[model samples]
Target: MGFDPYLAYYHSIDYGRASLASDLNPNEGVYLRREALKRYFVEYEGMLNREFIRQETEENTTFQKCFRLQTERLASCIQNTIPYIPFELGI
Candidate 1:
């Protein structure tokens, strides 16, 4: 294996599901136990575990709702922001 500190960190945290985000060499596993372990562990362990699926789903839904609301608010703010205007002043 190569000597990449980030890869070590990724393995330590077991970013199996979102491996592409962390793993420097993300690839499909055709005949490796490591692939099997990643599939198993992600489905049965850590934040993405079945036990927390409901919670994770709810959080993502809420995040999307809140994000949409915030973007709408930002759009309103932008629309109401002052517009530039040129005016001549007497010297």
Candidate 2:
């Protein structure tokens, strides 16, 4: 990764912090799991499996696949010195 983990776009700057991860995180919250890590992983899997319709193509895509596309877009934006367009899960 060419990015500095501490240099964030959305999160506030802090010493020795992984702000870039925060910026990319879709689920931004604290999950104090009573079911250990199992529930966390299960829920995350479910979220990734969830589907959404593409506005331009009118095709369905999983969030996991969308995440890959978004990552590629972000990398392209960085290399080309262009603005990063975030993924939108429309309501």
- Computed on alpha carbons, the lDDT of every model, listed in order, comes to 0.43, 0.81
Clashes of 2: 0
TM-score of 2: 0.63
Give one digit per residue, the lDDT tens place, for model 2 in 8-87.
88999888879888887837567676787788889999999998797746799888888788878888997899998887
Clashing pairs in 1: none
Best by lDDT: 2
lDDT of 2: 0.81
Best by TM-score: 2
Please give the distance, in angstroms, between residue 11's alpha carbon in candidate 1 and its true position after superposition: 34
- Lowest summed-lDDT stretch of 10 residues in model 1? 48-57
For residues 1-68, what per-residue lDDT tens digits would candidate 1 score against the true structure?
12324334354544444443446555554374888878876754443222321232343333334434
